[model samples]
Target chain A: MAGLTDNANAGAGRTVISVDAMGSDRGPATVVAGIDRSARKNPDIGFILHGPRDELERLVERRKSLRDRCEIRHAPDVVSMEDKPSQVARNGKGTSMWSALESVREGEADVCVSCGNTGALMMLSVLRLRKLPGVNRPAIAVLWPARSEQEFNIMLDVGADIRADENDLLQYALMGASYARNGMEIAHPRVGLLNVGTEEHKGRAELKLAHDLIAENAENANFDFVGFVEGSDIPGDTADVIVTDGFTGNIAIKTGEGTAKLIGALLREAFKFSPLSRLAALLALTSLRRLNKRIDPRRVNGGVFLGLNGTVVKSHGSADATGVSAAVKLAFKLGRSSFSEKLAARVASAVRVPQDDETSADSNGTTK
Target chain B: MAGLTDNANAGAGRTVISVDAMGSDRGPATVVAGIDRSARKNPDIGFILHGPRDELERLVERRKSLRDRCEIRHAPDVVSMEDKPSQVARNGKGTSMWSALESVREGEADVCVSCGNTGALMMLSVLRLRKLPGVNRPAIAVLWPARSEQEFNIMLDVGADIRADENDLLQYALMGASYARNGMEIAHPRVGLLNVGTEEHKGRAELKLAHDLIAENAENANFDFVGFVEGSDIPGDTADVIVTDGFTGNIAIKTGEGTAKLIGALLREAFKFSPLSRLAALLALTSLRRLNKRIDPRRVNGGVFLGLNGTVVKSHGSADATGVSAAVKLAFKLGRSSFSEKLAARVASAVRVPQDDETSADSNGTTK
Candidate 1:
């Protein structure tokens, strides 16, 4: 356990992250600016930047702080937004995204961060790092800004795959709990199975089976299974880790984001309704700005890929410098904590006993 | 077609709706108040209120408009919120929910309105009214306030059943289109299958099959099939009707509602942050009020159960007079337009051709 955990930073004095400086909508300049911002704030963090050597050298040279703390890796190719995952998996050897994951795989960096295509990044990370021993399918866990004291809840399987059987959902619960324990520093995360309703008898059969299975092993898994929760609980403080299949999680996250965007647009429109409203908006600008900063997506801009041997944080493709800096900060935090090894140990220790299988099968039959 | 379509208000001076005056959190008083509000606006509407005759008569007598428009029924039993669907199906004969649905089944009313447990209401409706021919499952359609010119897009399978095969989703498209045409007055509605991604190749296998099936029959069904849509499209103008399985639709709608509520609360908190912000809030109160009214859930309070022989409008259990009145207005609109007959005709005509079975199987094989 010690060797595996220490492999990330080993004898290093500072945490190092490999960043994929390609496929971001804002280009590598924004990525460099973001790294500069993050480096200015966190002097203990270093970066192994992966991109075209000449372009990255010039970009890093513009910032004295980044130039002092960053290493450049020349990966001339990039995975485009339109690149198919299968194509990238087969022919993505020299791409920046692939190189970033390779650094993590080779233990040169603690973790990897990318603002590239999500599908391509996931595929490359899975291909390079491989899934954990007992993990059926990998999941992408995003920290959602919610009403909890921690201000965020870890929601998993956001878009790694569209399907999750009962067993897969149980794995999400264990993996998400490990993430919360390390990423958010929660001792015993309260895990909730996302469903249509909070009733024990509601939702799909798979969900019910997952619910029972999660409950049966919550004690052994070192987490509190809070039965089932509805969509409202995602933003509320009902759970620390909300687990579901990729399809529903993806839809729910997008829906919440879309609603937030809609409300923001409406707020602007409302403030500009008339001269008096415009004056009011000007007067309340400070309060509105504070509110906006508190709920900004950039503040929680990294999606951690779980159930893999190494860690990969996927930042928003169109993230600006501040958003990119936030993602970098997240990667640094996870790296310093050796999140990958802790997660791996947690998953490994959470072995489902054979007797539990008999009980799970019986519950499945009843639920079905 | 003519006979069935004209049966709603055939030779009658007014369209009558049967009301289940039970299981509402606010009790019969709110139901009577809602009826009074709707009756005041629409003189051509009548109601057969189901509940204890003495209690309903007393409540109706409080309002002169309701006294004239409502005819009280002697239903002594009310369906409790905790009643299971199976229990309701076995022995719900004397319940107000049963009586209200019976009115629609017996042709005494154009539609039925209830503020009871949604699951129980759907079960009773399906048992009493039966599914329309060719319809594999019934779905509940709700009007989602969106960025469209219509201001609301119809979304189906909000919480009917948790599962939907390819055939069931195609039926949702047809049923949702019919509801939009009659309820929103759209000549031809645009239908989109809700998926994790907008790409035709993304999302679940059944969704891909449903997409092809919907596309192949969009012309025949007199609607446009707009490939796949994400959760954002539910509140966008891209599609007039968003279709998905019950599980996803229910979660999305609840998630949207929860997000809206959270934002609304946060806006209030922001406004009351300081004395200056409080002043600004007061100054901009008018504009804020207008914005609130535009997005108020009470205005779009009804969920119309589709794919059944008779229409059942399910209002929020905790609805006040305004929300209940909005639901009543929806029921009246569907009743006036003979929505049930049009929906049945639409589903009956958009038949899945037998030869397409081979193509569907082959596509499923490849996609799966």
Candidate 2:
């Protein structure tokens, strides 16, 4: 509750965008470059870069052009990609990452953006920022370009939780669907569970159970649950929201990203191999960019840590300056957006008191 | 097993390649055409078309010049792609697929190839041909041409067993390495386990345990254990052989295939959008083919169900004339080659008997 109030300053104040300056490939420089680029682009947004000072000061002092527009908050720690997610929250004391997270939780910044270790962020945030009343485990949700007359697809739980039961998976779908409705503002977003196959008996027992539970129980009627989606369907403009567990989702995302980049590289090499092909490559560069934009990792940079009380955007820890910038921009937009608040509100409103079918077990029931 | 065996009289007294003449994409005509073309090109290898008399007769009649060189064997039943592997064996009765498999199994034919349903072929063959001793789970090994001295990379157990333990995964690496040694026939094959990261803590519990087990074990000394490989390394000429569980491997293969096609299509459409680009595309078709060949799925058509008591090749269920032809070619090479025999022989030779230390259980007391 206090955490919400702290971050709530985002609505009325200077709109301070919290930068997890401690994270990212090139660290402070990358985040700073992104902030500079974004600040130059958006006049209304103010940024507070969170990290230890010497580098931040050097960065700000070095980039004289950005000094007037940006400010740095000193946090002493930095979480490396290799750092264990579980251990980092404790170890990253006084570090920029910890402070940046604190800034958002403390309401010093309206939004928080991190291109840091995802597991660390989740572990830290879930404990620090706290989970929503009924939410047990949090899930990560991503937005992908789908088709015309539709915005993009929503994918969930990308390496958030290792093991999920049927209930956890369905809850993920509900959270993701609610995210689509509120975050992207898609009305009645079609929901689909990712499966090895469309056949009911195809995947593991967990998937089969999840499918049956979701479909049979009329679990969440807010969105149209659009059944199962095969791996191929992720790229295709079929389902608006795709849901899967951590392992499969992470692999799917990486495979898609790797495969796309590989093809692009091949195309580049192919076109350059011969003079005539070079000519074609030059001619086709524009069209290729358009295609690239559709699948551009940047356009889909901000992955929301769903089921949390507040919005937390986990940018790919290895994201470049531009990618991190996009993530910050998304968080700013999402912070103001009606997605999570509405989802939480709906969840809160739907379960006024404990029913015969209480989702939570024992006397430790949820928001109910 | 007998049902899947090739007819003795049919394949005997002949020096011909048994083609599973069925409804391969582009049909029997293309196969006859490819055979006609290859036969025209190479005088040594003759053709024995196996299918219904009417279709084979029509094909032979259509190519009058090849009628003298090619022979037709009649088998009425057709193995539909959807048919279960068990059903294929039971109902193989007189199908071309059955005839082809039986032909090879019975030693009447040098090798049998069919681009029919991969599962059915795998099931029939693994049941019939049998896995070699010490081969726990048979893997479908594929060799990818790499940009290195070895010139190719081996990926195994693409889609054999759904869930594999450390043993299965490690066996995949061993089988793949052996394949690199003898199938692709590259010596000192470097084996890498595909993972999210190269570190021990990168993958699942099984992967972690597998990594330690492989490192501590002496069997890996026979080949170079190159540690973990991410998806990006796949495009580069990294390791000689990469091993993964069948689920991830299958998904990755499909993802790679689909992404390549997607990118290729995008590049073409982009090129054709402009007049000059169109002209360039027309001239650079060869370069495109060269690129395609490098990532050609067909180049590695026959995926063997390795570790089986016998040899079984699972070709693409939807394979066309060329794909099926390649599968047959692969089967002939694998069946004739001493890859498995050498592996069995080596394992047996090195360890005279199953010493308790030779096959130690992992930390979980589960066999690695």
After superposition on all C-alphas, the RMSD of every candidate to the true structure, in Å, is 6.2, 6.2
- Can you write out model 1's per-residue Cα lDDT over A1-368, one digit (the tens) per residue? 22211133322588898999998999999999998899899889988889998888778776867654688888999999999999999999999999999989998889899999999999888889999977889999998767877878889999899999998998899999988887888989999999988889878889989998888768766789998988888888889999999999999988888878877877788889999999989988977887887788899999999999889999999999999999999888888999889878767655555344544445442332
TM-score of chain B of 2: 0.80
Q: Per-prediction DockQ, in order?
A: 0.62, 0.36
lDDT of 2: 0.66
lDDT of 2 by residue, A146-252 (tens): 44245467778777875677877877877887777666677777777887567677667888888865664333335676677776666555677888877667666
Off by over 4 Å in 1: A1-11, A352-368, B1-12, B352-368
Strongest candidate by lDDT:
1
lDDT (CA) for every model shown?
0.86, 0.66
